[model samples]
Target chain A: MSKLASMLSTIMILFPGVAMATPDIIRQQLPQSVPHYWKWGSLFVNLQVNYFKVFFLVALLAIIIIEFLHFVIIGPKKFRESGKKIRVYNLFVRIVHWTAALSFTLLVPTGLIIVFSKFFGGDGFVRAMRSLHFIGAILFAISVVPLFFMWVLHMLPEEGDIRWFMVGGGYLTKKEVETGAGRFNPGQKIWFWIATVFGTLLFLTGFLMYLRKPNFVIPFVKYQIDALRLAAITHNLIAVIVLIMFLVHLYMSLFAVKGSLKSMITGYKDEEELKYMHSSFYEKIKHKLNE
Target chain B: MYKYSRMKFYCDENRCINCHGCEVACQVGNDLPVDIARRKVITFNEGIEGKEYSLSISCMHCTDAPCAQVCPVQCFYIREDGIVLHDKDKCIGCGYCLYACPFGAPQFPKDGAFGTRGVMDKCTMCAGGPAPTFSEKEKRLYGQNRIAEGKVPLCAAMCSTNALIVGDAEHVSQIIRERRMAHGHGVLDETPYGWDIAYPNE
Candidate 1:
């Protein structure tokens, strides 16, 4: 079969509900794509759009409120002495982190507008949103490349992660908790890995979704409709999960954890700040301080 | 008052030969760029005996068209005559309609890899879009607004086998019913898009 033949075959299979002339012959053949799986398709449509949107917004808001209160009640962690600063993050790392942050902030709103602003936005807004999304996607792709490589080694699951996770990464308890945290706690490690893995997946899926026309089906690349549908489903699902994690991440670093946001910005953390929160990391790097 | 007839397209599988006449005529009539086809014919059960069947699939122009429902730009409109039309100027070519549409009616000019492509182009059901009816601008963006000239679509008119039928849903339904009854099949009622979705009220 030709590439087009394969594509059309996939399309025909996806649309078995409409095709298949005789209603008498029961279609025992299962649909390959997620959308064509009987009521499963409609369920996905509702879940992917509505639940994803509601959950994302509600979780973000809830995280904000909780993090705000946590910050107020606990207050920022401060050492009595003017502590020496350790060069934890390099300048390049800070630049990449800010690039990721700025792109994400821009991306989230633009994505929400594109996905959820149907009832209100006109054609002009739609065009604008799409163009903006395309631009954001490029920046995001660039940021992801650097962030993935920069953080992958730092995010390796450590021996102390089990204790860190068991103690809820020192977040649940107000009493001084021995998290045995590295430069990043287990939670941050999880977020870093998820961000890289799922972020890469989103890019791949979004890339496939961007490709729309039938003419795109080259000989080597069998760009079938069913594959497109699958990619779209995965993209939406991954996006929702990633967004929730992102909100949680943003709150923890910026609002919940004191002095951490400054470290990300300045590539330096107070020596006492590191000793208090991340002793394991400080011990590892203390030998380098004398050099 | 809702006076205009509800329009529809019905394909009698029994008569269809999978000949690309309707497809060709539509492309020529529209002067559509090579990448896009406003109409197409698809076949199933190839090489298999008895089960081999084909259907001429294009925009059925549903009353509560999902294309209209899902369009981020709200580019589509259903005329009183039930023709589904879209404003090209408004379409950003995000290709949501292609995802939403069951018939796969929406086609874009650039169908290759990499970045964004051209604006969306799809079946206008012989009726031009939001641009002043029968105007040259409509013709330039969309193709001929032939429905305004009291003529059927070029594809339906050019179908040599008379397999692809286009008209008011009721009349077309009657023709299909009569044909089916003559062939000894029971009278199976057909709903023109919206009834299945909004059945009781519809």
Candidate 2:
């Protein structure tokens, strides 16, 4: 009897419906053929419960520590303000970039709070953070379209991209090195695509998760897919990638390249910076500057 | 002998008639919102001959409750009797519990902008929350503390066919064993539905 009971328990554990059948309605509602525990559900739970907070902390710490070391060792690139400022960004571009920046500023912190909700211990504060996250999503939705359209042309791959990567975009040395980079460096271009493309995916998955019961049906699929579970898994995975890239982008603009933040704020780039950081674009536009 | 008594809920598929009495009883007893369902009656192979069966499902209040494991705020607490309860005030309404729950027990009110989730509400097994027993605050937030009054959960109490039963884990299993034996089944072999997931150690 014990052997039989053990065998039955094993079967039930291995195949959920083998010992005591699951209701058809429950089956239809939460289709088991899709492998909820092994495939997606456990993965989502593990990522959310175990890894997300640590992942965010480690990523942030790694970036901060690495950037600190870089600043101490290699140092920030110092460029002489030649008093000749070129209007690199117009009013429209500045507005759009800041709008996206503000959204990211809101989104990233609130997202971290949500991940580390245990530390906050929930309540009105954490709840407020959740609401703030939604607000950030709305801001991102408004800014992302214009941000993409305005810079996509300049962000595309160019012959200079290879040279920029090979020389590490002159970031390793304090001395200025001519990197054949365009108006936007390869680093900037990569950040652009990740923010726009992966940001879109994040928004979509987040929306599905917000809905909680998307119940989306694929035409050819045999079993009903758990859309919310998939959304959650994809959202967390994409979030990690976006978060790391956002940090790098932040470090690059705010600290690594001195005066980079000022360029965005004042809508002007120093002539010296344009010469060394964007040598290829400087070559093309230098005549216009002289004229 | 067990060190501590574990409370559990069991729904007999053979006896359940799909009347949805438990669902209605729970809602009415708890004064639950229309959007929130603490208990649900699901039927298998409806309109089919010889293959039809029904059962009630809610928070299994698992020994290793997954919702508690996944809750970001650590609001969930399992009672000495193994009743899983959570502090509503501490919930941030993130809805992680919903994803982790195998039985889809967690329900959220659409209270936020764009129909985003409010705080989670689930079956408390009539044990209420961390609030003081029978306090007005407990009643206001978590509905009745029926367990504190030594009453069966409203769902089981009102189960028309006595299909849904709840009590000490040992007693529940004993009843199930007798029922199986009386039905000409010599020995209990198969685990009760959801037991493998909810109480794997049992």
Candidate 3:
């Protein structure tokens, strides 16, 4: 019985439809003959039909989910947080953040242009769309400069990070005690690292592709093409994760934590909330006042 | 643009002879790098004798161009004449275009001074490039946009069998219609060829 069960499981994985072929067994099983001269013409048409719609839907769904969650569920929650809630993200940071977002949005469409044009068909519209997409990529690189600087001062890891990652830093428990850390949290620091590495990979890969330089030291068009393919997959996967992180950030800033969004907009947080939420820094400042 | 009125390219498989003439003509005319073809001649069923026909595939420039819709910086533009082009300086070497293009047209050089070629090169429909008429930079990077100089693409012009055709939509369609009528109905089984061969290994 065990041997029979094992065989059944193997067949299930290797050929799921094979088990259901009892009815098909009696049906016509003749190999479909190719048209006399039709074989050459069917190659490009078949592949395009297979891949274009699948990838398009995956990308479209990811973007829509991220956007919907940010604007609808998370945006309002941070507006109602207690205590001081002003000035979390400065003007320069805000500018860079939005610019990065806009550039990323452009990258999606342009990327799609190259994919669909080859396998499916490139029309005049696809060509025009790609032009704008490349332009957006340039802007994404430009936006990085300002964003890089705004976070340069705050990215170093702190001792509290180890505890924060492990213990949820009182956020989960609602204990409302400030961990002895300054500036950003360990989670935010990790996000910075992800963005930095992935962004650099995208920039380097993108430029190489644009300049038409396919000669990797290994020397093959297929190699360069493969590398580019890997980069694209990585870029897309990372984008989905980052967008999800941004959704969390949006939730905390706008809806989860009341008055938190105000700090980003107006650049000031309430003193009482600061002391309650960030007691370590508050204590340092309050002590200095007593001195 | 709506679906029906959007511009498209249709390949005639019957006339192609596997000679790769279109591929070579495009490279020579555009000054594209060695081993870099903005357009390629692909054969689906080879070694079958008299059953093989080659298709020269490149960018199709779609109506609902997925690439344009996804660009974050809004860099794409639509010309009144329906030719699509871009600014190289404004391009970041992201491979998004590769994923989005269905025809696999855009190619990165991958062989330059820095061991990295950071710009994309592809067919500009012989419409020249993104510069003023006959500028050296446009000519150097994108080859001569001969269409702007009142010439059709050299590939189509040089087609030995006159298989490939290019021009305004109406003109090209009229030509194809005439060919079909001369050959009789169903004489050429309009099986869009490029898309099938483009992903053959998969």
What interface root-mean-square deviation (Å) does model 1 yield? 8.5
CA displacement after TM-score superposition, residue A244 of candidate 1 (Å): 2.1
Which residue window of length 10 is worst by lDDT in model 2 chain B? B107-116
Clashing pairs in 2: A24-B44
- Model 3, span A228-258: residue lDDT tens: 4444455445554554555455556555557
**Which pairs of residues have clashing backbones in candidate 1?**
A216-B111
Query: Residue-wise lDDT of candidate 3 within B64-144, one digit each (tens)?
Result: 444444432334555656566665545543445554555556666543223333456777777766667699988887787
> RMSD of candidate 1 to the true fold?
7.2
Off by over 4 Å in 1: A1-44, A48-50, A71-81, A95-99, A119-124, A142-146, A162-179, A213-223, A257-259, A286-291, B1-5, B48-53, B73-75, B87-90, B111-114, B180-202
Ranking by lDDT: 2, 1, 3
What would the per-residue lDDT of candidate 2 be over residues A21-47, giving only the tens digit for each residue?
Answer: 222222356424323455656677777
**Maximum-TM-score candidate:** 2
lDDT (Cα) of model 1: 0.68
Q: What is the C-alpha RMSD of each candidate to the true structure, in Å?
A: 7.2, 9.0, 15.8
Chain B fold agreement for model 3, TM-score = 0.82
TM-score (second chain) of model 1: 0.87
Candidates in descending DockQ order? 2, 1, 3
